[model samples]
Target: MLSRCSMLPSSSDVQSLQGLSGIRHLAESRRFKAWFLDQFGVLHDGKQPYPGAISTLEKLASNGAKMVIISNSSRRASTTMEKMKHLGFDPSLFVGTITSGELTYQYLKRRDDAWFAALGTSCIHMTWSDRGAISLEGLGLKVVENVVEAEFILAHGTEALGQASGSVRPMKLEDLEQILEQCAAKRIPMVVANPDFVTVEARALRIMPGTLASQYEKLGGEVKWMGKPGKIIYEAAMKMADADASDSIAVGDSLHHDIKGANAVGIQSAFITCGIHASELGLDSFAEVADISRVVALASKYSSCPSYVLPAFTW
Candidate 1:
């Protein structure tokens, strides 16, 4: 494992990171021990690499610091890894990766013995169609078409579910409730993979798995959240990094999820301003307190604030 308590840049040194040109120097000089890279905007956008990402990653990797990507991506880890390689990102640069899909699979695998015994094999998996048709038979569980035919249900992402609701499309709460009612009548439990209510894509807001899960819980149905800011995902990332509470850092763009999750585990965090909330950058709120003021307020209300803020991952 890499050394966690190794000397970090003091406040004066931190000021240097505010500039992109200086980052190369600091990284080359061993200012940071390891980087907790955010996969989305920092490396590749959902479909492709952002400009300068490859060079930045290559430079950092050549500088000798350990790099690990921690993402909320719902795709399987293998898919993400393959995409990275396709984009010409040196796979060796990343010491480890923790994706929501991979983590969810592990969680199911470990609890299989107990879950299988209690729930039986018959199950209906209700989630977004993008989650793919996963068969639990390989996991020793049976797959059923609808809730009525199943004893249990595994609910993953909700994109496909949202789109299929009505002609207006993008499943709304009212439409999802109808499906939940069907499962509820049969007393089926669902395992929620991604637990975000909504995610900002570029500038527009879109529903996520958490949005449906929240509604399900309100209707007395059971759900499980996977990935960041969640304790399980945080714990798994730490274990992979071989890092302790005080020795690690979490860098992400989401204030509610990334920042809050880091605080829950007592780890330091750096908020990247470009991804979900790009408009907040270069504002007084950001300049006055580094992190978003709302996040600063939340941190103060619940716990300590982030260690620093950058305009973007590169900066």
Candidate 2:
């Protein structure tokens, strides 16, 4: 269980709830006009779409609720959309997607902000594959193979480094200490494209960019995170949905990313326990309703009190 200190900043106005019933509860209650849905555990498990995910999306769409699929994926929005289509999701179901990769790319491409403008053109690109580097093209940025010759570090996460070593497991601190040490010595700023510590992929949780970025910050390296738990992404999502905070609710499986982020932005949140915390909460199946006390305890542990709790995203 995650301690309170580990959770992201939350809003003081939103009090703790007893438990969540189901997605239909929110719809029936007419509590929100727009829904920001998470893509990973809530919609699919990486390999395929969840059993009722498509239909649930259809139901929400028919209800005239604005839907935006939010993701902490390191891939660009277009890439993410392509993958979602391949996985059998209807593109017309949601208004648009806001991915970490897309946000990072937009920031770099426009350089409208002070932080992004200060960044140099040459960077050491770190990713699982060359496809990850595709986001940097047409932005006048150069990708260098070596950290020593780079002006900044573009890190997707440690997963790529682990894969390069022929390991299917998540990368640990020891696996990245050497590279992190070099960047730290140079005081190089790192652009973390994805800000999720762990993501569910086919029932298996894997470490993501946020984990490595946290370690890098601990080692005295400057890091810029572009995804959830940060206010920027939430603001971007709200703008895309064109909804006010009071009428918007964020639904996701991770407390650290989804619930905490929603609270941070003063938007209502629904905690879906069947995704990443299923085993920890003793839930044997996605359809199994979690004990109210267990759900309350989990929320208390994270110091984030979501407005509702549900076993899964179903109508």
On TM-score, the candidate that comes out on top is 2
lDDT of 2: 0.77
Q: Note each model's CA RMSD in angstroms.
A: 6.0, 5.0
| Poorest 10 consecutive residues by lDDT, candidate 1 | 160-169
- Model 1, range 1-315, lDDT digits (tens) per residue? 321212332233223234444346446553465667767645655556656677877876776656677777665677778878897787887878877767766766666546534655565554555435433323655555556667765555564342212212235446666877888776677766666565555344456666667777887887666777687777777777676665566777676667667766766666655555554443332222243454445444433345655655552
Report the backbone clash tally of model 1: 2
Residue pairs clashing, model 1: 121-142, 162-171
Name the lDDT of candidate 1: 0.60
Q: In candidate 2, what residue range of length 10 has the lowest lDDT sum? A: 162-171
Best by lDDT: 2
lDDT of each: 0.60, 0.77
